[model samples]
Target: MRTAVCSGSFDPITLGHLDIIRRTAACFEQVWVCVSPNAEKKNQMFTPEQKLLLVKAAVAEYPNVRAELWPGLLADYAMDHGACAIVRGVRNATDWDVERELARINADLHPGLDTMLLPAAAEYEHFSSSMVREMIRYGQPLEKYLPAAAVELVRKMRTELNREEA
Candidate 1:
């Protein structure tokens, strides 16, 4: 079976991320979303466990899709999870250039695994986790890029933060 893993920090998954996951899910026999916790990232709004929960909830409709937490090396996470390939999304030329090199190096190191870059949907080409956080921070509408549930969480969190400040 062709098992592919989609790994990302998924601070709060956006519709763009959802688009890639759904599209890739149709192609692979099974698709696993690995919530990668980036220790180097300090501005995270949600914990890794929270990210995993959100991913699991978002992907519950797809029986062929499963969500899990990945805390270490990405290639190792893919291999350990029985993923024959890693499905990555590219939003622009720069993203492709960077991801392409990483893919080549990952293949060389893993030998048995491969990486596939899925182009972002037209509307989602500019959607990003950092952008989502910024939107939430600035109180901009984000229904187009995120689901209602995620927006609600952002709203609640923002309100609570405001209360704390007050």
Candidate 2:
């Protein structure tokens, strides 16, 4: 089976992330949506477990896709899983710059693994997890930004957080 690994922090899986996963699933027989940590990103709204739950819910429709937590290096994860490629989503020039460098590093770490950058679809080009988090903090509607499968879970989590804060 041709497997591809798609790694991201996914603090709360957004529709854009789902779109990329769907596209990747079509190209590869097996796709692993690895929810990895980002040391650079602090004050994450969701825990790793919460993130995994959100990812699972967001990707439930894709039979070829599996969501899981990955604590180690992404290159290592790809190598361990025997992934032929590491799939990444590119939304804009800034994303391109960052993903390009990461791809180079991953290539260095796992010479056999190739990186495939899929450009975001027009509707999802502007959506990102960080933006979703900001919307949540400000009490904005999330129906448009998040996947239908994950919107309710995110709303439930928000309600729980509100109760805790109150």
lDDT of 2 by residue, 114-146 (tens): 999999999999998889999989989899999
lDDT of 1 by residue, 57-102 (tens): 7787888999888777788988887889999999999999988998
Q: Give the root-mean-square deviation of each candidate in angstroms.
A: 1.9, 1.0
Superposed by TM-score, candidate 2 places the C-alpha of residue 1 at a distance from the truth, in angstroms, of: 0.3
What is the model-wide C-alpha lDDT for candidate 1?
Answer: 0.85
Per-prediction backbone clash count = 0, 0
TM-score of 1: 0.89
lDDT of 2 at 147: 89
Error of 2 at 80 (Å): 1.3
Whole-model lDDT per candidate? 0.85, 0.91
Compute the lDDT for candidate 2: 0.91
